[model samples]
Target: MSGEWQHGLLGCFDNFTLCLISWLVPCYQFGKNAEAVGESCLICGLGFLVPVVDIFLAIHIRGKIRESKGIQGSLIGDLLYWCFCPLCSLVQEAQEVGGAPQAISMGRE
Candidate 1:
């Protein structure tokens, strides 16, 4: 694959990884599963693999992106979202700015 493709592909995976890590980073939340941190990692990590949930997750951690330093470490997942899921982003922006999403049906035109 091209470099851009690789960036996007790996980027999304990295993003998911970061989101999972951030969600589980509080440490206390994984108290019961501390014995199996590996498995806990996988579970929290897998949560970001889903569609919309993952995107919101990325947004959730976005604030930490700056505090954690450059992408990767704590911010990789957030940055990866920039590579993936543009439609959702646009709609979100529209809703936030426009207040509500007005459906524009082709049939109407």
Candidate 2:
């Protein structure tokens, strides 16, 4: 039940609306992504306001997604993605989870 990410990290153009939304309201988008993984949307969303907390949250969520999907990745890679291309990572996770409640339900055991 595990595999690679359905959406590539740089394939932002594949979902233009998602990319735009993630860019415009990152906290909201991050919240959505976190919620998809059964995390607290409000807390994770607000974590963006903190300087380093955001990175930690991003890394943790990315790990969750990778574990759920059986995608191959590392902590350093996740950190780099959050540091260099956070919006992309957000969109990537959102896309990976399909941004729908059903998406996570189907992804879990």
**Going through the candidates in order, what is the number of backbone clashes in each?**
1, 0
Q: TM-score each candidate.
A: 0.27, 0.86
Off-target runs (Cα >4 Å) in candidate 1 are 1-40, 70-109
lDDT of 1 by residue, 2-31 (tens): 212213322323344333432444232221
Output the TM-score of candidate 2: 0.86
Task: Give the 10-residue window scoring lowest on summed lDDT in candidate 2.
Answer: 100-109
| lDDT string, candidate 2, 1-109, tens digits | 5567888889887878888888889999889888888999999999977899999999999999898888998999999998999888888899998873232355546
Instruction: Enumerate residue pairs that collide in model 1.
Output: 15-77
- Window of ten residues with lowest summed lDDT in model 1: 28-37
